[model samples]
Target: MDNYTPPFNQSLPQTAEGVPNKNSLSSYLPIRTKGNDFDFDAVIGLVLRGLLRKKVEGYSYEQFVADCQSAFEEKLGEEEFWQVLKEMYFENKDIFTVSPELLLFRAQKGEFAAGDSRVASMFTNLLQNMRVEEFEAKLNFVEREMLSTLREKMKPDSSLQASEKPYLPYLSKAFREDLKFLASRPKYLLSEIESFLSFYGFTYTVQLSLALVDWRSGQEPVAKPLYFIMDHERASNERTHIKNHGYKLFNESATRLFPMLTMLEILQPSSSEKGAIKVPLWEISKGIQESKLTHLKERLEKFARAFKSQRNLDTVLDESDAALDWLGNVMKLALAQFSIGERFNINKRYVLEVEKYLASHFIQNRGRSGRVLVLNQDYIILLTNLVVGEKDKLRFYELITAFEQRGIFVDKQTEQELIKFYERIGNVERMSDSGDAVYVRKTI
Candidate 1:
């Protein structure tokens, strides 16, 4: 996981030219014109007021529109009202809570860049009731009851509410000594009282369950709520950073690789391992964002021309020939998402034991009958075979574990698909009960 922080922290301790103002709508709202003077500023001001006054709760889109209309005393048309609200939302986003319906709509419709959930959560958290706050409040209520009971020297009795009844004896010498010890600790030592009260988040349940926490074993129950909020905020900020600038480097490389790949996809429509597997050109395209489609047009043309002009006919292209296929698709996706650099390097050698497989009467299965899901599953098996050598064999569990360790998975549904492929090509055989074995064509 990335350390949760803003992505663009290169700027000095000052605001740059176009960043949003944390407290004001000046940066977000458009300036009003002279002729129509619709008093948007006044409307927005009142809307902000209503939102802050009812900040802890939310409104449906209809309720929100009606409330704004009632509070501002304006009868703008349907189009005009929504337009006004949209402008206000942009300008006062930091302070104002947009309806969840609108947030979800934007996120779903791709209006939100990368459609990241954390960005939605950051906005939505403001409008929703937080559970942790209630948990913290319950702990505080319990502590107060316990303290008051002790001060009054009340005896433990079934008649009192459980919260009011102190668990520790009020008049005991041990209780006084414990209080004295707590008082003697440092100024920030009030958290020590968590021990006196069983402050854990879980506890003894009655007929009706009450809020409880295991306070004695962990951090103070009262403080857990604050930690939860802070942790959530950190994660959200980290995701926002990733979504905003996560693709900058790959986009640059995609620019470089696009034209070269375009030529390669046409020239070689199947996997590079000499007819091992055939995948169509479009699956590779679906693996990336639509934004990547037109990103490096100008630069890629120059590289594409050079790549074609200087090409050698006998030169092996490796699996990148399937740039629009699964082999090319997975590699491109990894580079686009996981790798970061300016240069686009296109060199792959996926088929290692080509002669051995071919000699054993196993030609690459060029019959295309699967999607990206199946292609990758078979890819894991083939790559595993290369590492372990076809002469030796690994157990099914060991093979799957190896795949997982290398960030690949041979899922349960894909098991039969792999079995079928191996059955078609006899060198890779299932050892009946052993689930392990290798055979050279007919000689088992």
Candidate 2:
């Protein structure tokens, strides 16, 4: 009996077909029966201890059973251990649960504890029996509590009635951080503006309208709650300036202020169909305005200036310029096509016209003495003007053709050669066929 040590650590033998055999109670019974006189209570205690420890240690089902066997043999003799194990196994099979902490603990320690399959099956069945609305209500309750806490943290200085609590509670952690940052800031920061814009769909009508007024005046607004200038001097000034300057001051001003306005609008509470506060927009705005947001406005403005300058250039002379110009053009063309109620179809030769116009301008603007054409800051400014006009492909071609038709003599051979060069180098495909012909293959 003393010599009958079980093959505890040995790898199980494989079947004749090479599949490994599973361990069974009968396989260990011989070693259990052969052990010397065993103490049943001590064996039970050891088994329980091993099981509990294994539960903490996160042992797998097979490893757990093996642990139980080892504990039993160390205390009770092999014979009585099986009887005690059998009794306990049948009595308390249903009372077990695993917590997230316990799961994490086991994972950290590399313990492979086997969960009760029967318990999981039953729990899943219970969940399956619940209605979707019941589940949603439970989730909503949790969300409501979370939102209430957030609303309290975001509360404005003014007193709020009990009935005026915010309805939505499911804000992302980033949004909460943005709110706090905005609340700390003395003035609007880019992060706060960006976050607010993201919250809403980036539409800020009130701010846009107000900015239009300021742009016309070429000055900042005097106070908040800016009134719309219907027939004001500023409006007249803006109209005259835009007409003479070939650019809209109002548009430029709107672009500059758009982000902040967008943020404010998004942070505002949604209004009910009956014009009641579904959530107070002012409260949200107040919190954001108070927060100290990270300032990226300077960097953004620099980038915008560089971008605008690049847009004005005829041909990108450097790799960096080329990449920037390509991106800007793509965006511009996409926006222009979208605005014209076109789904990027080849219904009109708009893009081609623009390219031709640019090519003609590039030729006409070159140095007359056969010198290397230097694309300076002035050239970039000129190009910017061309881009803003949103000229179509046919118009651009005509512009170029007109320049060539004049005595400007833009090396016709070079111009033609360059046209072919652009067509080949720029992957410019001509869609001669009608009705989405350019994208028919793409759709397929």
In TM-score terms, which candidate is top? Answer: 1
Q: Per-residue lDDT tens digits of candidate 1, residues 1-444? A: 123211111211121222222211110011111111222222222222222222212223344444444433444446565556446543454212212112211221222232122222211222221111111112233233322322232122211111111111111222233333333331212232222211110111000011111211212111111111110111223333222221221122223223233332332222334323212123223222122333223222323333323331122223322222332332233234222322222211101121121111211222231101112323333344433433366565666454333223333434444555556665455556344553222111
Model 1, residue 350: distance off in Å is 28
Q: Quantify all predictions' global Cα lDDT against the true fold.
A: 0.26, 0.26
- Angstrom error of the Cα, residue 377, model 1: value is 9.4
| Weakest lDDT window of 10 consecutive positions for candidate 2 | 24-33
lDDT at 158, model 2: 13
Question: Residue by residue across 1-444, what tens digits does model 2's lDDT show?
Answer: 223211111211122232112111111011111122322222222222222222233334344345445555665668575556545442352101111111212221233212222112211221222211111112233233322322232211111112222211111122233333332331222112322322111112222223322322213222122111111112223233223221122223323222222222222233332433222222332232332432222222233334334333232322233222332332232233223333223223322331232122222121222211112223322222222222233332443442222111123333343344335444223464321222111100
Clash count per candidate: 12, 30
Model 1 is weakest, by summed lDDT over 10 consecutive residues, at: 201-210
> Which segments of candidate 1 are over 4 A away from where they belong?
1-13, 16-372, 376-382, 389-391, 434-444
